[model samples]
Target: MANTSSAKKMVRKIERRTAVNKARRSRVRTYLRKVEEAIAAGDSTGAQDALKVAQSEMQRAVGHGIFHKNMASRKMSRLSGRIKAIGA
Candidate 1:
């Protein structure tokens, strides 16, 4: 239990932030899934287009402190590599 009013307020604030973060995470995952689906379907052009959108969404998530910069970069790198391999 929160013993102080300040602690209660902090808990409330944390809950709100958690909800927002969850939504952002879900959005980023959705974009990433789109890219994966396009790649799996062997549509390189579509995958590239989806990757463009996913990259922006991912960068935005990183900017919002939802993902670490290096993690985002790594994910983008792997996805781009897959896209390239599909074209090859």
Candidate 2:
């Protein structure tokens, strides 16, 4: 379907980028899930630690353009809020 050489190259580039992005997304979600699990278990200390890691990973994803800046910020905000509520 790609009629030109450039288009074929672009398709290859896109495929590689998609795989990288998918991996990053999965990694970010794994970190988030860890935070959620810690919060759900009511382990404040564990949750705090996990949140720190998750926040870092999320910001990294944003930096890589895997997530929008505001989306990452919002997720971090909500997760932090839940962490705070765990102690209350």
Candidate 3:
């Protein structure tokens, strides 16, 4: 469907970027899930550690433009809050 050679190249670039973004997103989700699982298991220390890793991954996602800055901040805030509430 691309009419020009440049257009075809653009399509290829988009596909490559999409795959990279998808992998990044998946990695971020895995980090978040680890935190959630730790929280569910009531291991505050493990949850805290996982939350730290998740926060780092989320920030990386924002830096890479895979997620909005505020979105990542909000998620980190909520996850931290949950981590705090776990032992209280």
lDDT: which candidate is best?
1
| Local accuracy of candidate 3 as per-residue lDDT tens digits, 1-88 | 9999999999999999999999999999999999999989988999999988888889899999999999999988898898889989
Off by over 4 Å in 2: none
Superior candidate under lDDT, 1 versus 3: 1
Between candidates 1 and 3, the TM-score winner: 1
Which regions of candidate 3 deviate over 4 angstroms? none
Tell me, by TM-score, which candidate is best. Answer: 1
Per-residue lDDT of model 1, residues 1-88, tens digit only: 8989999999999999999999999999999999999999999999999999999999999999999999999999999999999999
Superposed by TM-score, candidate 1 places the C-alpha of residue 37 at a distance from the truth, in angstroms, of: 0.5
lDDT of candidate model 1 versus the reference: 0.98
Per-candidate TM vs. native? 0.97, 0.97, 0.97
At residue 76, candidate 1 shows an lDDT of: 99
lDDT of 2 by residue, 1-88 (tens): 8989999999999999999999999999999999999998999999999989989998999999999999989888998898899899
Candidate 3, run of 10 with poorest lDDT: 75-84
**In model 1, what are the clashing residue pairs, if there are any?**
none
Cα deviation at 76, candidate 2, in Å, is: 0.8
